[model samples]
Target: MSEKPVVRSSILPIPKSIGLVWLNIALALILAAIGLGVGFAQSGLAAQQVILYTVLMAATVFVLLNYVAVVFEARAEARAVASEEDQEAESSRLRQLWADNRVLAIAMATLLVLYLILTAAIPEFRSIKNLIGFLVLELILLFAFKISGYFAAGRSAFIGLIVLFALIVISAFSIEGFLSGPNIKAILLFAAFLGIASVGQTMVALLGGLDLSIPFVIGSSNIALLFLITLGVPSYVAFGFILVLGGIVGFLNGVMSYRLQGQALIVTLGTGFAVAGFTQIMTSIGSQFAGNVFGTVPGWLSNLAAMNGRFFGIPFPPTIFIWLAIAVILIVGLKTTTWGRNLYALGGNRRSARLIGISEFKYWVGCYVISGVFAALAGSLLLGWSGGAFIGVGDPYLFTTLAAVVIGGTSLLGGNGGYGFTVIGVLVLQVLTSFLLGIGLEYEWQQFIFGLLILPMVALYGRSPHIRATV
Candidate 1:
């Protein structure tokens, strides 16, 4: 047979590094223009703040997107070539330069523009106080971003030290006695509480399951604790009981999910409804029984309920203790324990896990149990923070927790996430919420904005494009 000559096809040329850089610059300009246009339409100090925030966020997103695109594009090109050594070298050079320079350059440019706008809009902004405030704000961002990057780049142990340093710096810069120490402490306490709550959801997500029941579970537990408190139970005893109850609920979820062999979403949703109903009933019971046991309730319990008590010269609520305890326990459990390893294994590949002699059912049960305990702890904290549980106490947490977990970079699809990401995710979401409120957005608008923020993160990190491609 006559041999035919082989012909290589090269119709679509791979995009060059310069081309990608130009594209990124173009995107940044478009983002900047849109942000300024929005600000101009709004017409006030609020508008300027919004514009600055928008520019920062847009620029950050642009950098991240471009980084991902460059990495993936290089990989794709490498796969097509006879030899990828030169291509990889070129890609690496481009990536290193961009990472080292682009983000900072954009940040500096945006800050300069914001400074001009602030000076123009508010003449008072030129004062020393305003300048100091801007410097403080910049420092906070620098610390936060540096810490995030440090841990995200795989340096885990340094995270705590970085956070501690950041906190110390923030406290040092604070207007001493400007706000009562107790009030400040309470705010920090609540922030920690919400952060831990988000961590629970993140853990579940890491295992490749979404527990929609988290809200209801939390609400029910909170309501239960409130009922116990109203019935004259000591706070510590109530806390213990709530924790046990949460564990039981989690066990049930694990059992049901494993036995039914159903979708985690469907299973959790069903449980959530059931738990929510139970919570409403519990709330009604607590409200009715409050007066009957007022005399029996201990003075210490009542004092603890207020969340303004002083502990070791630094005023903090009991909820803060709960948050700290939960954070420590969960973080350690996930990182060090065999059960945690199993959850990750199961999440990554259930079939492979089984082949390795890992019990999918047992680990699944354990995950639910852990989730339940954490949710319960969150519920108890909510009760203490609120002075008493109210209806829908857990409702907001459901979405927020999921958002925090997803935002923190925990994959929604099973595996490839951690508690650290959840913590950062929680902080980011809370700050964003606070910022939105400060800007005077309506409640509905806040929810809408959060959803918008959360969707992108979830879409980017949660789904596994590589896995799908391989499949």
Candidate 2:
């Protein structure tokens, strides 16, 4: 008797680009139809119009999310050595888990329907401004995701770039007015703040030094500047004073690290803790506003924070340009200037640098000073943006700044990174955080996500040639 052989069927669905492309195309058409319908009618939010908008948002979310899922799924597979069955099992679980994308899509759709029918919908929902914003945003994401497939991993920043775009696309669908001019600008502004702080971090990383006290320095500088302003110092002068204060802190860090030699981490950490404790004391005793200290910082300072002005058609503060300028200066100065070249060499190998007459000690002081000054500058800018600073204002930035530098592909051992990489990392973290918020994740959840993410990124770089954590 001949027994029929049983064939094992794979459980996981394979990655199919054609299907994702079709899904994106269909979503695009739906969004277009919704925009056209809204465009054709200049009037109220009727039941039919609400349904259309709701569907548009949901479909947009579905496509954007699925696009990201497929990309990640493909990445996982490429990185995997698992058996076909295991891949299938994981794929199946992902399918089940992410099906909530559709469910949540429907849920948001339903919520929109009910909200529009019951309450008065805001006029902003029907505006062409929103339509154009969304269209432009989606188009960019779709294109970026498409382009990302062409690049090799670790060879470029394309992965982080597209991942950011996909997240923003989903945010546009999930968070109302997320794609609008104001929200996007707000994200950029925050990114700029991180960029400012990252400048110091980048330099320190370049010199194979770490500044753990950055958070407190930034927070304290912010409060100190406000304290100065209230004491009748000019805003510009107050700002300068904080920068000087930051330099002092950085100088202290350098002196300690230099004296101890290879103890930059411990020195910076101790200083950071000390500064943080003092800042807390100051916050408790300083002028109060709504249960928190409100420095009487001047108006124009706030204007920079608020990005009150714009060039041509662009929004104000122009923080991106500021970040770009900082990066450019760092690159060129490091390339063209003797100090910059020495700094890189010093970072690359201290013994060799000293042996070659690079003046390692002087470079160390300058590097730390630069780091401190930038930290203070970042703090002051943030204070202006937020109306004032609090005790923990710079706390989150400590980790975020390090994560940004590392993610930007800057080597932990130093002498092998750029501001461009830091900027990309800054944008990635900012966009990810923003998207998580848009999806209604709480603060704790956001922190959890950062923790989960930062480890992997560090681990990825930690194995590279320049990683010398013990050193």
Query: Between which residue pairs do clashes occur in model 2?
Result: 12-88, 309-316
Per-residue lDDT over 399-462 for candidate 1, one digit per residue giving the tens place of the 0 to 100 score: 7787777666667777666887676666556545554454455787667656754543343221
Q: Where does candidate 1 clash, by residue pair?
A: 208-414
Judge candidate 2 at residue 387 and give its lDDT: 87
Candidate 2, 1-471: lDDT as tens digits: 222222222333323566765666677666666665665565556757766776777666565656565666656555365667766876898898766344333433443443343223434345554455444544553454345446534423664565466566656665678887777787888898998898888888888888888888888877778776776888888788779889989999999998997899999999978876666576557444421456566777776676674544566675556666887888688878988888777777788788988887788888889889999988888887788666568888988999898877777677777677788889889987887576565687568656755553343232235523334
Each model's lDDT: 0.63, 0.70
Name the regions of candidate 1 deviating beyond 4 angstroms. Answer: 1-187, 232-234, 282-307, 456-471
Ten-residue region with minimum lDDT total, candidate 2: 1-10
| Model 2, position 298: C-alpha lDDT score | 79
All candidates' TM-scores?
A: 0.60, 0.64
Q: Alpha carbon lDDT of residue 400, candidate 1?
A: 79
Best by TM-score: 2
For each predicted model, how many residue pairs clash, with residues at least 3 apart or on different chains? 1, 2
In terms of lDDT, the best-performing candidate is 2
